[model samples]
Target: MVEAVSRNSFKAYDIRGKVPLELNSTVAYRLGRAYTELFQAKKVAVGRDVRHSSPELVKALTEGLLDGGCDVIDIGLCGTEQIYFATFHWQLDGGIMITASHNPQGYNGMKLVRANARPISGDSGLRELEERVVTSAFAEPVGAHRGNVQVCEVMPDYVQHLLSYVDIAAMRPLKVVVNAGNGCAGPVIDALERYLPFSFVKIHHEPDGEFPNGIPNPLLPENRDATAQAVRKHGADVGIAWDGDFDRCFLFDENGDFIEGYYLVGFLAQAFLGRFPGAKIVHDPRLTLNTIEITRQLGGVPVQSKTGHAFIKERMRLEDAIYGGEMSAHHYFRDFAYCDSGMIPWLLVLDIMSREGKTLSELVQERIDRYPCSGEINRRVSSPQVVLESVEKAYAPGGQIDRTDGISVEYANWRFNLRMSNTEPLIRLNVETRGDRKLLQRKTEELLVIIDGFA
Candidate 1:
């Protein structure tokens, strides 16, 4: 039986925690063994990010998988999506990505998937895996029948698949600012540069596990200046930034203004609806009016799923949605096994700009003015349930209340969604208004006051 292991890392979606304490070589090895036993995986693909602890953890994980008689295909030093690609692209039994995404340094995690690259989150198989790892549910290695390891290169084909999303010949010669934030996206940009016409002004481009330029999450307002300044300095037409694992990408306009991911949801929804009329577009509930209007205007259906990758992917498959997006910058495609891709969103945006003969700002300026939103604001609280109840009690009286994911209260001219973070101990609030920035600001402040009351 395995000794007691830290269960704090087993989150609702993936495994993430501080190095050695919550996650270490021992945990990774048992996880690999539990995963093989749970899914009966014979051949699995394993990929990892540039975290300092990744290589050591991956080494132990591989040994455990082999001990379980599961052959391992190592796709080294890759982003999370690469593991998904390697699994589906190679028809492997499953895939495991060693990454902590945007988490701070000295921390790491893993994203797991079964065949077809479908996520194995808490409800599906992760809970079982956790139980096994916690209680010692692994058998000894079959010495004679141990699995072998093979190193495979997935970058070339992955790049080709990304290029398939846009018409290369139609792309204009525009200067684009690409910021990898010292994560995994730099190599991807380099690989795609030769095939594109855009000149890239790269920033924090190399994969440095130490995070010399800070964590690659552009979602925070402070982390965005580097990408925005690069665009202004280089007179670039657009800017793009990706997180550590590159599953989510953020965009900036030619004016060096950071575009909210909420706007991009409606923008990309419109793009997909233009190509596939009457198709279903799945979106999260946090920010919805803009996406709903655009989807309906373009003769497409708007489906609202809970704000999460696992939930969104399931909804996409259930509705056969052509596309899915979150205000948090995760954009999913039907063609890419319903998996989210940070690379694909920017390429599609470039295609739209090239075809419409409009700048990035021009493309989204109207929507921005029409549906101004207070970008997602997070506040740490002691009791999230109490805070949520208080907000719902105060706001749900006259407004339309929807509890699909959280308490989303909508009035005729304004709307806001209040939900607790799934991974962290914080309450997240998103507020938007119909062409009224003043009302948006007022309501956001009002909500913050109520949220802060409990704290």
Candidate 2:
């Protein structure tokens, strides 16, 4: 049995915690054993970010993998997606990525994938792995079936795969600024642009484990300033920035305005549906009407799935969805084995601009005007269930209620969703009204009052 630890360390999606206090070499070693035993994986691909603590944790994890009789292939200092590529490219039985994504520098985590890049989450296999880790119930190998380590570079193929999705030759000359936020995206973007025709302006494009600028999460308003400022300063056509692992991307228009991810979803859905008519496109429940309308207009089917990457990817694979998107900037594609890419969305959007001869703002303006939303507001509350109940009761008389992903109250002219975060003690609220920004603001304020009342 693995050693006992705090339940707080085992998160909903993966194992993440602060180093030394919550996560340490011991924990990593135990997790390695548990993962290998659970998957019966003979070979595992391992990768880490440019964090100072990453090397130590990776070494411990690798030692445990070898102890569990699983061979390890170490891809040093790589983004999370490259580990996914390594898993499939090398035909490894499983993969483990040591990264906290856009989390603070003090935090670290691991994302696991089964053979063929299949995700292992709490519901699928992570819970069992956690239990094994807590108990340390690993069996010893019988013979000399020890694992070996190898190093291979997977970036060239990954970049080529991303570029394959868009036609760079047909792209218009675009002045683009990419802020890597001093994260792992630097090397990948440098390699990718060498073959493209666009004029690229790079910022914070070097991997600094110290994170001198700030945490690389673009969802936070403060972190977006560098990219937004760059867009205006350079008079660029568009600006793009990625999180720590480069899993999701955020965008700014020529005017340096932050474009919401929902609008991007609608735009990309339209683009893919144009090519694959009548195909299904998946979207999270947070922004339903815009995606549904856009998909219908483009002669495609719109399917709403629960939030988060794992759920979206599962639905995409089951339904063979050509594309899947979340209000948060995660965009998944069928061409990429139903995996989400921080790189591909921007590429496709640029292609859309070149083909339509329209600016990014112009392409998404209609959808944004039609479905004005008060971007997701998070409230810390003592009782999330009670707050949800209050909102449901208050709105139940006027419209339909959906508990699909969260508590979604729908009316003819407007709708909103109030859902609790899986990883934190907060409830996320997203409100949208039909072509009325003021109404969305009003409803949002009212919902905030109700949520605050529970506090």
Give the poorly placed runs of model 1, Cα more than 4 Å off: none
Candidate that scores best on lDDT: 1
Candidate 2 error regions (>4 Å): 140-143
- Candidate 1 local lDDT, 242-299, one digit each (tens): 9999999999999999999999999999988888999999999999989999999999
Q: Work out the TM-score per prediction.
A: 0.99, 0.97
Q: How many steric overlaps does candidate 2 have?
A: 6
RMSD of 2: 1.4
lDDT tens readout by residue for model 2, 1-455: 34676555688777788987888898898888888888889999999987888899999999889888889999888888888778877788988999988887788889888887888888999889888877766677545876778877788888888898888888999999999888899998889888877899999989998898898999988788999999999999999999998888999999999999988998899889888999999999887889999899888999989998889989999999999999999999888778788999999999989988999889888889999998888889998888888888888997988887879989999999999999778999999999988888888999899999977
Q: Point out the worst 10-residue segment of candidate 1 by lDDT.
A: 133-142
lDDT against true structure, model 2: 0.88
lDDT of 2 at 250: 96
Judge candidate 1 at residue 288 and give its lDDT. Answer: 92
RMSD of 1: 0.9
